[model samples]
Target chain A: DTAVSQTPKYLVTQMGNDKSIKCEQNLGHDTMYWYKQDSKKFLKIMFSYNNKELIINETVPNRFSPKSPDKAHLNLHINSLELGDSAVYFCASSPTQRGNTGELFFGEGSRLTVL
Target chain B: DQQVKQNSPSLSVQEGRISILNCDYTNSMFDYFLWYKKYPAEGPTFLISISSIKDKNEDGRFTVFLNKSAKHLSLHIVPSQPGDSAVYFCAFGNEKLTFGTGTRLTIIP
Candidate 1:
């Protein structure tokens, strides 16, 4: 079984269009994260949720919002998407402890392209 | 600013040679370090990790060495095979994980 999965593996939309990517993990993990990989292959963390509580919110733009309905799901919604927003978005999950040393299990990323 | 930095963008190694990938971090607060391998059209998978208290950790052909004083870490793959060719990312785990720009390793047969 796929440990982690995301919907719409490929997304192509015009500039200013809004889109949403859904993610789910079956790893029974307590923490989930959203990371963006740019054209340069630089991966940066965007948001994180631990047991449905927002934990880490990076310096991402306001147009990006993350919602975790439950511990197994974390979805990202982008508004007013721009050309610079074109990149690969990855969803990952990890077991959370008081001092977490766990590794992340990532889903097949969702590629977003803005024209 | 990028806290974790992998200076080499790409590396090529022979099938039976040792591959050394280096990483540097500026955050002294980072206590745990990890290496993740990514293939095309796929998300990264965790490879190996090292703690600030330990200088080296090894698993099979993969070994990770951490130098807290220098704030540097390296992943050494012995007898690198073609299947090992992938993008390797160095990451630091604190409240969250921060990744470095990946290094693409190409194993030549």
Candidate 2:
């Protein structure tokens, strides 16, 4: 079984439109995270949820919001998408909150292109 | 500011040779260091990790070395195989990992 899976592997949309990417983990991890890989290939953390509660929120735009319905699912919705938002979004999960074990399970990334 | 950086964008190694990828970070508070290998269109898979308290950890053909004083981390693959060709990322932190850009390793057959 796949430990983590993401939907909408590739998305092409016009600017100002709204789009959402969904991620689910069957590994029974309690901590999940969202990271954006920019054009420079830098992976930056956007948000993190631990047991359905928001924990880490980096310096990101307000247009982006993350929703965690349960410990297994985390969804990302972007409002008024911009061209600069074109990047690969990765969803990851760790077994513990602090990840003291130093391991993470990631999903097949969702590539979003805003035209 | 980018806390982690991968200076080398790519690296190439021949089959049965050795492959090394390097990473540097500016923060020293990280208690754990990790390496992840990613294939095309696939998410990164955990390869190896070393705690800040230790200098090295090995697993199969993969090994990770952490230099806390220098804030440097490196991944080594011995007898590199074609299957080892992929992008490798170095990350550090306890709660939230800060990842380097990534180093693309190409193992020639």
Chain B TM-score for each model? Answer: 0.98, 0.97
Q: Cα deviation of B21 in candidate 2 (Å)?
A: 1.0
As for candidate 1, its clashing pairs are none
TM-score for each predicted model, relative to the true structure? 0.97, 0.97
Per-residue accuracy of model 2 over A1-115 as CA lDDT, tens digit each: 8888898999999999999999999998999999998898888889999999999999899999999999999999999999999999999999998646668889999999999
B1-109 per-residue lDDT for model 1 (tens digits): 8788999999999999999999999989877899999999999999999988999999999999999989999999998999999999999977688899989999999
Best by DockQ: 2
Q: In candidate 1, how many Å is residue B32 off?
A: 0.5
- Chain A of candidate 2 gets a TM-score of 0.97
- Local lDDT at A103 for model 2: 84
Backbone clash numbers for all candidates listed? 0, 0
- Write down the worst ten-residue block by lDDT for model 1 chain B: B93-102
Candidate 2 clashing pairs? none
- DockQ of each two-chain model: 0.71, 0.79
